[model samples]
Target: MATEELNAIEIEIARNRLSSIAEEVGSALIRTAYSPNIKDRRDCSAGLYAPDGTLISQAEHIPLHLGLMPTMIANAIAEYGAENIREGDVLMTNNPYIGGSHLPDVCVISPLFYDGELIALVATMAHHVDVGGIAPGSMATHATEIFQEGIRIPTMRLFAAGQIQSEVLALLMMNIRTAEKTRGDLIAQVSANRLGLRRIHELVDDWGVDGFHRACDSLLSYSERRTRAAITKLPDGTGTFTDYLEHNGLYAAEIPITATVTVAGDQVTVDLSETADQVDGAVNCSYAVARSCAAYVLKVLADPTLPSNAGLTRPIEVITRPGSLVHAEFPAPVAHGNTQTSQRVVDTIFGAFNEFTEHLVPAASSGSMSIVTIGGIDPKNGTYYSYVETYGGGQGANPDGPGASATHTHMSNTKNTPCEVIEREYPLRVERYEIVRNSGGSGLYRGGEGLRRSLTLTRGKATVVAGTSRVATRPWGLNGGGDGGPARVEARTNGEVRELESMGSLQVGVDGTVTIQTAGGGGYGEPEAGR
Candidate 1:
């Protein structure tokens, strides 16, 4: 049947069925994974794609991961020809230059076949705790180049012909610190893809291969039409804004990220060609990351409920200069770029929209993920343990109401690692976990409050690394609202308590405590007259 002949009901049913499969695969990964980062924090994402690499459906997981997964899959197929891909073959890679967010975010791709013909593809991307880098969690703040970050895996066959490649797996295990945990996470990703394959096969069985293809084509066309209509609703104009990264790990100077948004007719263009050049620090990101941030911002302003697929990006164009902060070239470190720099990109894009677009853009939130990584030997078991967690902050207030408090915002969509799980899994103790009251800005509608979390080492010493932002720069409020509070990090030793930089590492002795206070969201409007 022709795609044009498919009715709205049939298309809607296919969309829901495919989306459910993606969500189910994500749940399977979270339930079966061994690491707390995946099982508890849920730092993984799942997606289904067409044979030509167009994204069909994605789990409502991390925005950063979802936006970049399609590019990664396309790159993989380009390098390793689709003709070379066969049933039971799984491809994997984490090379930032080859369409990846960071070295630690490993992606596994599996091609599904129906009756000896390539029908669909299923993939998953997860942030492994450690991938053999200068820092324990593979997110080295002071790293100068990608080589120092971690093991860079290009597109290769992790599983070929329904068999596990032992030598290939061994090579990866030899480079990282926690081999067993990494192995478990990798297997979990593979298992999730297998589940996706089975579900897709079942779908093909119900609707013949040709009918399934037609439904997918119809869905794509519907989403594209919706996106274009949304774009046409915005007033045609161009607006530009610039935001800064507080620190670039090696230096304390702010790095600028600029976004120029132009909405014309039924399309939008985001130009980042004038942004700062890539720095020596780990604050630089790849083109894929830049594209993802721009795509995310457009979706928020245009239509948040639009189906997340390749069609949604058809009306958006993101342009970045080579070697710029947003589009880093080869060898530049990008560990912090995926977390810290991505937030700045989102802020700049939204700030630009606020300048001209009639859409009510919210004030800036905490503007940071506040990632903390601690790696050490567990005194109880004498084994190496790597703890990775990203803290939540206040959400920016919008026209509708006040921003939500102590929540993950923007590019990152993840849950905090529970205190009990943290204490039980690693050699750490939670000393304080509470909201920093009054940290949010005051306006007619107040911004959300930030949180303060402190952790103490239980037994042995460990290397603690903190990567955050909004330290020197406050989250700017919209219209007449007040700016939000700034983020702060402190380390306490036996008798001395010293403040730490936004992006740096420190050695914590036994009983030492590291406290992180995230920034609050910006207020929505001017405060009411006070007595």
Candidate 2:
């Protein structure tokens, strides 16, 4: 099959088939995982790639992971040498400097072969519950360097020639607290990739190798053409906006993040050179994470329905200064940046677009993921347990209608762990879970509301870490609308209550309770006179 012979129908069919394979692998991972983080919250992603490491298709999972996985796989291949890669070889890495978001987000890559030739690659990334650090969850708020975060695995082989490396597996399990759960999740990731490999081989068998290659090329070309056309629709101009983070995990001083978006004839460029330098805390991000945030904003402003392949990002360029907050250098703590700083990057980029795009974008939402991690010994079973979950907030209101309440938005696409799962798996209880009324900004079209959740320790001691933002600054509104409320965290132990900072940690005894109240979204327009 020649390039000219591949029709639109063939391209569409190939696109759907590839996307289905990615989604299937993701579902397999979620079902087979053991930890509540992966099994209950679904904090994982899967994707299919070309032999040369170009992203072809991905499940509609985590925006941050989906964008960064390609870079991690490409870097792994480069470091290990593509020629040295053999069939049944599964590569693994979680080094942020080498295109990973953090240490806990372990990535595994495997090559798919047909007729003794490399045809494609299948990859999956899962966030383990514990990876050995100052804290059990590997997301410490006070860590000043990468060594305190977790075990850093460079590009290496976890599986060779279809054989698991027991030595390597044993070394990894020895460093983490929750060895059993982590081992289970790691096996689940491997199984998910194996499934993807089989599905890809079947696709090749049906379409033939030549036909499959042609279809993939056609799909990439189609996405590139559509993206360029979408850029042409937006007026050629430049927009700039700057936002702030409440703290850098170690200080109360605000850190600034600025984005400048420039739209030309058929391309867009996002510049973060004006952003502040990386701090000595865990609020910095890798360059790949920065690029993902920029790409996500472009997709939201342009046609979002466009297939999320390498071609979709071909028309966009991201510029960042080395050693900056958005592009941290080696050894800088970055566990919190993957979730917390990523949200601010999206907000700053969208705010820049709204500056000159005729107000096409919506107002700001609760700019935080509100991560909570608890680690302790289960008294009933005398086993270690690490519980990690991210709480959702409000969605920004648009010109068309009001925003939705109590939902995850931008950079995070994970579900909350069910109360029953929490009670069944750990020594904790969900005492209170409800929406915070009047938290949304008042306007003609009101913003979305936030929520409050409280958890109590059942019968053991534990270490708890709470991370969030927008506690000092409100979510900005558009077109004279009101700003939204801020976030709050508190802890109560032995009849004494104490407030916690935006990024804080504490040791809790039995019967202690930790409460989290997320922020709300901004309104769309000015409010009417008192009704």
Candidate 3:
């Protein structure tokens, strides 16, 4: 009898197993990483790809990072030439123009070979605390060019032919403020990919190389079919919406992120060609980011149980113009683009989709990552230290119930750094850590509340960079609901208190205090009469 073809049960099992491999890769990266950004906050992603550079499966990690990996793999393969990628060779990159979201996020890809034939690739992307730029954390707010953001890595062999490239390694560590930490995290990424490669070998052995490839192809097609069916459920029409960034770091001007979502039959197109031009600040985003946000919105709106892969992207078409905020070109500073601007893109798409699915979509969420980076020497230990963390804000209110309070949503899903960890790791103290009550918008379903966090310098001067949003414009509510509170940043030095811009840098002298009050989510629906 001929071997049976793949059935629904077999396809489902293959999908789960593939996703399990990706999840294990993520777990290894977190447990072995050096920086709190990766270990504690969990700002990293892992995925498995077919030899032809298609996304097979990914761990449920940062949405922005996960959505951008397929292109990164394709670019890497093109630059290195598929025939040249041998066993034990790993490629790396973080240049936004070269299929990356930003500089701090580094992508590592390792090819898997079975019976002298390349079968698959395992990839991982992590946010290193430092990569050597104008700032200690490499996330400078006012940098006008990508060079100032950090060292841009092209598609090159980080590890060639089973040998670690020491020159490449030294060149990377030489530029960043936290060399040891960066090096440690990079090594952890390599190890994570190696672990994933080992698992892939085991899987291929169990199913045979041909059988494994067949399973991947079948699952990818299944995901596409499911996504197309979900799109057909929406009313065929056009929905347009626009959201704004309070300001890019260089100037105080409203930057618009607009999207016109058109759903025709079983296809969806998100047109972002109407967004503002690229600004002379670190707020510019790349094409990958725009595509990622658009795909993310559809993923959330579609079936909740849809398995994530390249197939999920098949039914969606994303349109963006070059030199625009959503699809910036080379050398455009985009440190804030990945974190701050990406959030607004998601909100804009959701806003447009809400026109047709009001009950399904939530009100606006905290439209920023509220990123803060602090670095200096620890006077007590005489060792250098750099800390980068993104604070949690309000999540949008949904029809099902109230929004989640003090949480990271959408493109970013990092956990808050524990107050105790902050103090123990660096020369600082958490002065205040509490929820800002009444910050969320009011309606039948209340939005989530933001957080109030204050940090005091215990000793030694430190440089502080704040890249936040939702200051001038507040999170929007829906159907007669009230808007949420605005974001605020302030500094108090030597008995003098002054307000701060949403995007800027400052020096925190000893005993000086910096406070950040994040924005809340938007409420959903009109308030009911009486109690």
* Cα lDDT tens digits for candidate 2, 170-217: 999999999999999999999999999999999999988888888788
Sequence-dependent TM-score of model 1: 0.98
Best by lDDT: 1
**Any residue pairs clashing in model 1, and if so which?**
none
Q: Global CA lDDT of candidate 1, please? A: 0.90
Off by over 4 Å in 1: none
Measured with C-alpha atoms, the lDDT of residue 293 in candidate 2 is 91
User: Of 1 and 3, which scores higher on lDDT?
Assistant: 1
User: Against the true structure, candidate 2 has what lDDT?
Assistant: 0.90
The C-alpha stretches of model 2 lying farther than 4 A from their native spots are 529-531
Note the Cα lDDT for every prediction shown: 0.90, 0.90, 0.89
Ranking by lDDT: 1, 2, 3
lDDT of 3 by residue, 1-531 (tens): 123447899998998899999999999999999988899999999999987679999999999999988987787788779998888899999878967888999999999999988989999999999887888788889999998988999888999989999999999888877888899999999999999999989998899977887898888888999999998988887889999998898878898889999999999999999999999999998898998998899988877678899989999999999999989997799999987999999999999988776587888988999998898777887767888989888888888888899999899988888999999888889999999999999989999999989999999999998878888889999877778888899998998999888888899889988898889999988898851
Residue 433's C-alpha lDDT in candidate 1? 97
lDDT of 1 by residue, 1-531 (tens): 455546889778988999999999999999988899999999999999987779999999999999988888898888999999989999999988877999989999989998899989999999999999888888889999999999999899999988999999999999999999999999999999999999999989998898888888888888999999999988898999999997988979878888999999999999999899999999899888888998898888888998999889999899999989888899899998988989889999999888896537989989988899999777778888899999999888887789889999999999989999999998899999999998888787788899999999988889999988888888988877888888999999997999988989998878999999999999978788880
| Two-way lDDT contest, 1 vs 2, winner | 1
TM-score of each: 0.98, 0.98, 0.98
